[model samples]
Target: MSAWEQFITYVSQNGFYIWTEFYRHFLMAAYGVLFASIISIPIGILIARYGKLSGFVMTLGSIIQTIPVLGFMAITMVVMGLGTTTVVVTVFFYSLLPIIQNTYVGIIGVDRTIKEAAYASGMTQFQLLLKVELPLAVSVIMAGIRTALVVGIGVVAIGTFVGAGGLGAIIVRGTNATDGTAIILAGAVPTALMAIVADLIMGKIERMLNPVSN
Candidate 1:
């Protein structure tokens, strides 16, 4: 049978298991991105405000990003041990740089004239940020989030190496089998589809949030 045919046959016989793995994979990515956003956005805002700290922060993030995913996971496994916790943490680390850098850029990239106008109108610093800067920067920030999320989805597959349980498990199973191309596709194709769907959804949101440019 062809790979596609084999995939269909496998799914028909193992639909429940496949679905469960898909859900787990999604959960890992979602949780990782969620926490990364929570942590990174605030730090981004702080660095943007300070100005002097941007280089240091960006350098740190760059260093973290340079580490191979497997190497990072190996280090994390030592500290956190094997499980979903380590997987989620690893994903969170991987997702942080893009979000932080984007948030910083977006906030700082707001037009100086607009900021002056807001200040002249007697808006407080906090109000200025919430009302003016963030609104204007929402599109850029969303783009960063979209990037991180798509990357996170792919990274979650690596969790299988540590027994965290995801579609990667299926891919690994296929790799170990004699005729496993079909099985690997069963995991990979869905992952790619998920990333595409996420990107489209985030794109819509970014467009909606973006201010109408002149």
Candidate 2:
């Protein structure tokens, strides 16, 4: 068979497994990231607004990030046991730094004049944050979310090692067998594609939310 024919055959044969597993992992990772985003964004905004102890939170998140993926997986498995729950928790922990930092930066980066104008217009603190700060900072927050998504997609592959059974199953099994490069490629290629698609979608959203021109 030609390369195209082989590719088509592979997709035809394994498409269901690939698509189902991919969607499961994607949703799991997205849930973790969503939780992280919800918790971190407001905290980030507060830190930025108060200008206090941002350094500490960033440092804590950095330490969390420095833990190796395999080590984290092993540790989580021991603590939480082998399941999707452990994996989701792990991904959640991993996603916090980027989201928090981005939220802080985005909100803080809003133009001072715009904030002043809101105050002049007699907007309450809540009104200003909801209407002006969040809108202006949305692009930055989305950028963080995009970064978390890409990173989570990569990291959550470790889930399969503990029997969570997503696309990572192919990758972990492939690595174990030593000659399963095709399986590895099957898992990895879709992840890269997903990341690219996610980036494009988020980029469009970011542009839509951006208050500044160009």
Candidate 3:
């Protein structure tokens, strides 16, 4: 049989297994980004308030990004050991740069005149952030999340290396089998589709949040 026929056969036989792996893969990516967002968003807001700190924080995030994926995963694994926990931690580290950078840019990009107007209207700094700046900046912040999530989805595939199951696990299994091209496709096709679906959904949400959207 051709590879396509084999792929369909494998998928039909293991539909439940594939679905479980797909769900696991998505949860790893989502959790990693979710945890990062809780911290990075606050850090971004702080650095935006302190212009001098922006340079240092951004530099730190960039430095993290520069680390090779396998190398970074090894480092995290040493501390956390194998399985999904390590992968989630690795994903968190990998996801920081885009979210932090975007949040900083979005906050600072708010118009100076609008900020001034808020002050004139007797708004406290915190009130201004809540009522003025954040509302305007949310779209750009969402853009950061959009970027982080897409990248995170890709990164989670590497989680298989640490014994964290995902679609990657299926691909790895196929690599050891004779005539495993179909098995590899069974894993790979879902991963690509998952990423594409995620990107499309996030893109729509980002555009909706954009203040200038008609």
Candidate 4:
């Protein structure tokens, strides 16, 4: 039979297993991005408010981003050991740069005239940030999140190497077996779909957050 036929047969027999792996994969990426956002958005706000820290913080994120994924994972393994924790931590670290950088840029990029008006109205620093800056920067921040989410989805596949249990496990298993192309497809196709779906969803959110007057 053909590879396609084999794939069909495999899925027919192993649908439950594939679904479980896909769920785990989705969770890995979702939790990672979620945690990163919680941490990074506030840091971004701080960086924007204190211009002196912007360069140092951005540089730190860039340095982390430059680390090879495998090398970072290896280092994390030493500290975190193998499993979901390591995978989640790795994904979280990878997701940080874009989110934080975009948030900082978006906030600082707000028109100076608008900022002055807010200041002239006696808005406190917290008030200006919450009412003026964050609202205006929502679209940019969402764009960063969308990018990070898609990237995290792809990265989560690497989790299988450390026994974190995602679709990557399927890919790894397939590579280890004879006539495993079908098995690899079982994992690969779903991962691609996940990324596409996440991108589309995030695109809608980004558009929704953008000011209609703009």
Best by TM-score: 3
User: Candidate 1 residues 1-214, lDDT tens each?
Assistant: 8888998999888889988999999999999999999999998999999999999999998898899998899899999999889889998998889999999999999999999999999999999999999999888888889999999998999999988989999999999999998889888888888889999999899888889742
- Stretches of candidate 1 exceeding 4 Å from the true structure: none
Error of 1 at 94 (Å): 1.0
Off by over 4 Å in 4: none
Every model's Cα RMSD, please?
1.3, 2.0, 0.9, 1.2
- lDDT string, candidate 4, 104-204, tens digits: 98999899999999999999988999899999999999999999999999888998888898999999989998999999999999999999999999999
* Model with the higher TM-score, candidate 1 or 2: 1
Error of 4 at 161 (Å): 0.8
**Could you tell me which 10 consecutive residues in candidate 2 have the lowest summed lDDT?**
1-10
Instruction: Estimate every model's Cα lDDT from 0 to 1.
Output: 0.91, 0.85, 0.90, 0.93
Ranking by TM-score: 3, 1, 4, 2
- Ordered from best to worst lDDT, the candidate numbers read 4, 1, 3, 2
Q: Is 2 or 3 the stronger prediction by TM-score?
A: 3
TM-score of each: 0.97, 0.91, 0.98, 0.96
Candidate 2 residue pairs in backbone clash: none
- Native-vs-model 3 lDDT? 0.90
- Considering every candidate listed, which one attains the maximal lDDT? 4
The alpha-carbon deviation from the true structure for residue 59 of candidate 2, after best TM-score superposition, in angstroms, is: 0.7
The TM-score between candidate 4 and the true structure equals 0.96
lDDT of 2: 0.85
Task: State the lDDT of candidate 2 residue by residue for 29-61, as single tens digits.
Answer: 898899999899988988997887799899999
lDDT of 4 at 21: 97
Evaluate residue 189 in candidate 3 and report its C-alpha lDDT on the 0 to 100 scale: 95
